[model samples]
Target: MLLAVEGLTHRYGDKTALDQFTMHLNRREIVGLLGPNGSGKSTLLRVLSTLVKPQTGRVEICGFDAGKLPEAVRSRIGVVFQTPTLDPLLTVEENLLIFGSFFGISGRALHERVRHLMQQFGILDRRTDFAKTLSGGLRRRAEIARALLHEPQLLIFDEPTSGLDPAARDDFWKAIEELREKRSTAILISTHLFDEAERCDSLILLHRGLRVAEGTPAELKATIGGQIVELVAKKPEAALETLRAKFGAAIELSDGILRVEAKDAHQMIPSLVEALPGEVLSVGLHQPTLADVFRKVTA
Candidate 1:
């Protein structure tokens, strides 16, 4: 395992941040940490990056015990925090140089590494531009370039695309895919965006600081089974009872919406419309998606 965590738990006074969270990551894989706000994603990243110590747990990164040898673990991991860390006043190349120096890289070797990263990230032409003058997309690329200067075994990102526009987000993901292909670096990124999560090789879904589910996007969606039927009705609870009674369907009713799973939802929709009559305001049927799976698991 490139990374392994077991029985990881953390607390802030009376509130629990992580409850027996456990996960394993392999080399050359991108794993996404997924959850809503306050689900312990940030806390988990902090612990893994050695920024915050867990109250109880075992963590191993790149064959080194994270809890006992934090420095060794740190040396093997690169972290891009949720907030931008680049110095706005520094030029793009200068920023990379500063970050590289922190890893004891210097002289001709550091310059060569910096040039390689700049070229690889396609920011070589912008090397002399101040960080503040670059667009959001370019700055994000620079941040990633800086993080890779040390060539760490694992790279962790915390909502790295938080404020990026759609085009910028896509560009960032392209860079991520390139990293995987070129360096074979194991990646673990946290994000609330469902589309971003879908790009991951696998996902760990968290709820209230505990892992509720884990799988590839396809595997996770498959758990919902067949097709998903969503209905907006005047009386959701009543519609839920009717649907369950008539079709023996597994139903979920919340917030004026009723959802059920069926093998042939298209055939069943007509029957539903007939049975519900005027109660159903709208109906939709589709195959399960990551967003749907997340909703079901976290509900």
Candidate 2:
């Protein structure tokens, strides 16, 4: 394992931030940390990155203990925080070069790496522009470029697309996938976005500072009764009780949306329509998605 953690725990006075959290990461894969806000996803990342001390636990990377050899672990890792923090006074290339030099890359090697990252992220055109002048998306890209300058073996990101528009978020995710293809970097990230979590090879989901579930997106989704049937109707509230009473443990409605979890959606649709008492707007049948997994486990 490139990264390993066991029995991790942290607390903010009386509230526990992590409860016996244990996880591992392969040498070259992106693993997402998923949960709602305050689920301790970010807290887990901080422990892995050695930003905050865990009251108890052992963290190791490449056989080096994280608590005792934090410097060594940090040197081999690149972290992109959720918030953007590019130096306004420095040009994009200059900012990247500065961070690269921190890891001891300099001279000709430094320039080459900076150029490659700029081009790779589609920001070569603005290489000479100061970071403060760039838009939110471009600045976030520049932040990513800076983190990759040293070619760290493990890369960690925290909500890389939290506040971006749809187009920018798509572009950011593309950049991350491209990096994975190029370097096969071992990545760990904390994100609330369901789409982001679904893209990961595996996931650890936290709910209120505890590990509620852990698995690949598909695996987790499969545990939610196999199938998801979405029933759309003109009178969702009026029909909910009938569906619930009939289906019992198999159905629920929390937000004007009803989910019917059964072995076969096609077989259940006829019974569902009969129970509903309005013009059916539509019906969708599919296997459970990552969102469904989160909702079922967390709700």
Candidate 3:
């Protein structure tokens, strides 16, 4: 196991940030922490990164107990935080060198590592460019490369693609996938984005400081066990009432939209339209997705 967390819990005075969370990760596996805001995703990452010690339970990284051997854990793990960390005034190469120097790497070894990482991440051409001059995607790539300079076995990222455009996000994930394949690194990513969560090998879904569900993306979606029928109604409340009378608990009202989950939902559409009788402005049906799984588990 590259990372092992057991019965982890943390609290902030009256608020419980984490509650009996347990998970294990293996080498070269990508596991995503999927949750909404205030769901303890950040708190979990903080504890794993050793920035915040867990109030109870154990966190072992690369065979080192985080509480007993924080330095060892830190050395074995690399973290890329949600916010930017590079110095805008420094060149990309300068930023990486400075970060590596903190790990006591220097001279020829440091230079070679930097060159390899930059080349691997496709940022060597931008090595001389100031951090402020790089685009959001390039800066993110540089930061990931910097994190790997110390050759940590585990890489932890917290919403690493935040604020990036779709194309940039795609490029970032491509690099991450390549890194895992080539280095056999274990990765833990915390994200609220559905697309990003879907790319993980498995996911731990959290809600209000508790683990709500855990499984591969396909497994979780399969738990929903049906199709989703969504409609925007002309009179949402009335439509909801009408639908509820027919579909019972299978139908729910969210954001002024009526959603129904049923086996073979496509066959139900005609009945739904007839039941609502022009109240629905538009309707759509699709297979269950990660978003649907989240809604089901959280609801």
Candidate 4:
């Protein structure tokens, strides 16, 4: 395993941040760490990258123990933190040079590395531009490039595209895809967005401090089975509990919207109209999405 974590546990005083987490990543695999707030996804990344100490369990990245061999582990893994770390006063190239120095890289070699990374990210034109002047997407690309200066086999990104616009997000993924093609880099990505998870080779969905489910996007979606029935109701909140208790595991509530995985939503419509305060606004029968499976698993 390129990255292996087993029975990992972490705590802050009496509160548990991670509870018995177990997962792994192979070379060239992109694993998405997905969860709601405070679900331990970030905590897992912190431990794997050697930024935080775990109360229990082991993290072996590229055969080096993260806790026991801190220097060796840090040398092999690259991290792009969720918070902004780039200096606003420094230009993109300058930032890369400064970070590359940490890896004992400098002179022509470091410049060449920065050039290659900026070209890969399509930011060579902005190499001299200060990070503060770059768009959200460009800054993210720079940050990722900075992380890659040492040519680490594994790359960790936390909420990489959280505030990016649509075009920039697409551009970021394009860069990552190119990175995957060129280096076959094992990427560990943490994100709250389901669409972001879809881009990964596999996903681990979490709630609170536990891993609720983990698999390929297709495998996770397959957990729900059959078609999803979206019930457009007039009184969604009021009707949700009744439908769920009646429909059991098939029913789901999101905002005023309701979803049920059933073979025959059309057949069930008449009954809903008669009992519900409003007529059926609409009913959609479609294949279950990753979100649907996540809902069922996390509910």
Q: What are the per-model C-alpha RMSD values against the true structure?
A: 2.6, 2.5, 1.8, 2.2
| TM-score winner, 1 or 2 | 2
Cα miss at 174, model 3 (Å)?
A: 3.5
Of candidates 4 and 1, the better by TM-score: 4
Q: In model 4, which runs have C-alpha deviations exceeding 4 angstroms?
A: 241-249, 277-279
* TM-score of model number 4: 0.90
TM-score of model 3 (CA atoms): 0.93
In order, the Cα lDDT scores of the candidates are: 0.88, 0.82, 0.89, 0.82
Query: Any runs in candidate 2 off by more than 4 Å, and if so which?
Result: 162-184, 233-238, 279-281
Better of 2 and 3 by TM-score: 3
Q: Kindly indicate the candidate among 3 and 4 with the higher TM-score.
A: 3
In candidate 2 the C-alpha lDDT for residue 92 amounts to 93
Across 1-299, the per-residue lDDT of candidate 4 in tens digits comes to 78888999898888788899899998878999878778887788888888887679988889988888888988878899888889999999999999999889989999898998888767899989999998877888888778888878888999887667776678778767766778777899998788888989999988878999989999998777677778887778767777766667566778677777766665766665565656468777678888787777666
Clashes of each: 0, 0, 0, 0
Candidate with the greatest lDDT versus the true structure: 3
Clashing pairs for predicted structure model 3, backbone only:
none
lDDT of 1: 0.88
For candidate 1, write residues 15-69 as lDDT tens digits: 9999998999988899999898898998999999998876898888999988789
Candidate 3: misplaced stretches above 4 Å? 165-167
